[model samples]
Target: MGINLQKGQKISLDKEAGGGLSHIVMGVGWDAATGKTGMLGGLFGGGGGNIDLDASCLMFDEQGNQTDAVWFRQLRSRDGSIQHTGDNLTGEGEGDDEQIKVDLSAVPANVKSLVFTVNNYTGQDFSKVANAFCRIVNGANDSEIARYDLSCQGSHNAMVMAKLYRHNNEWKMHAIGETGKGRTFEELLPQIKPHL
Candidate 1:
């Protein structure tokens, strides 16, 4: 079992992986928090449909500038080091709603940080969602590393959930859990820059 992290917490990935960590999967999971309907039809007044939450990663260099991004529209990064599993239209099932796989060893040397985010692509905010969480898993062994539960329910449409950054040549994970309003990663750039 891995540590259950809280907002603003930081954990050394190299220490947890015994300093040989090369690959990881950032998974975001959630379920619609509809009341009494037992379904997510017309819950937010947006429409009688499910929430479409998207998982995305923004790659940045040491200067904290965006070098590349991997999201629903662009499934892979320029260097093929990061890949998005695809968009999850409905926050259903028992596991992750979306997953972003990253090869740490393959990431360009200039790249220093990877910001993982979840956004409400359907314009519905998190107040209509529940059980939201972001977790890191060992891609090689299928073991979990750490998990941060997004327990805040509000009208925000997006979240700058967490990030994996380089420190002393080692990678560390930080639980940001900062809420924002955006339908895509492009709009959240301003909010994510501070954390980088």
Candidate 2:
């Protein structure tokens, strides 16, 4: 089993993967909350609808400038080191609704950090979502390294899920459960700057 990461927790990817960590998979999953009873329930018409959540990766330089991005629109990074598997419109899956693959060795040295984010493309707030989680897996053996459950429920439509950054020449994972209002990665850029 992998570590169940809490908000603000950090783990070394190199140490976790036992040193041969060339590639990793970041998976995000969620399901629509059901049977919500309140004003929100009425607004969502009893609360059982497809939630279109988009998973995205924003690459930043050592100076915190955005160098590249990979999301539903652009499935691959400019340098081809990162690739978003695809978009999941309904949020109706047993496993990961979306997955982003990162080639640690292939990532340009200039790229210092990769921020993973998820937004409700359907414009529904997180109160309408449930069981949301982001996990890191070893692409070599398919073993989970760590997972962060997105348990914050609120009016926000987006979340800066987690970050993979370079520290001491090694990559590390940080669980950042910050919430905000945004329908896409661009809208969340400002909120993400402070964390980087």
Candidate 3:
């Protein structure tokens, strides 16, 4: 929906053309410096991880103002997304949960809307307390495309933004909810350039 792809431009999942790419997520909001600060599944080596819950996500438009258009969605499982809870933050979980999918039939039928974020995380000592989010389960029955929230302040690094599409017609989610005091992601790129 929020069209803008150039950082690698390769959008063909070619699974026989029903659609191509479909999964890629990167949420960074909770850092104490580097090493473990809190929660992330069983710990060390058990074969399953990711669960740094702090909770916070919002989207209101009957009167609430704080819009930031433009979007990003690299979710798969046929848009119902069902994998990669990797959660690495500063421990490096392979390209940080490499989420880069969008094969809604190659997404060029005049896309609609898509954007999300919660960019913050630095861990090593303390300062903790962060919130994160991710959801895109529509059609095939998973139906969820709206769990946006990016709480604000307490910077260790911030860039929490959100926006999803298909208003009145169907799907919806417009979030600027919070988080972007500018710290890393390159000073949150001028607060994400007015949501581009």
Please report the candidate that would top lDDT against the real structure. 2
In order, what is each prediction's RMSD in angstroms?
2.2, 2.0, 12.4
Tens digits of per-residue lDDT, candidate 1, 104-170, equal 9999999999998888998877877889888999999978889899858788989999989999988
**29-137 per-residue lDDT for model 3 (tens digits):** 3322223233442354422233232212222233233222222221233333222343343423321232322333333323354444443333211234333333333
Per-residue lDDT, model 3, residue 104, is 38
lDDT agreement of model 3 with the native: 0.33
Give a tens-digit lDDT track for model 2, residues 1-196: 7899999999999888788899999999999887776777678676556899999999999999999999999999999999999999998869899999999999999999999999999898999899999999999999999999995889999999999999998999999989999899999999999989
lDDT of 2: 0.92
- TM-score for candidate 3, please give it: 0.29
Best candidate according to TM-score: 2
TM-score of 1: 0.93
- TM-scores of the candidates are 0.93, 0.94, 0.29
Rank by lDDT, highest first. 2, 1, 3
* Candidate closer to the true structure by lDDT (higher is better), 2 or 3: 2
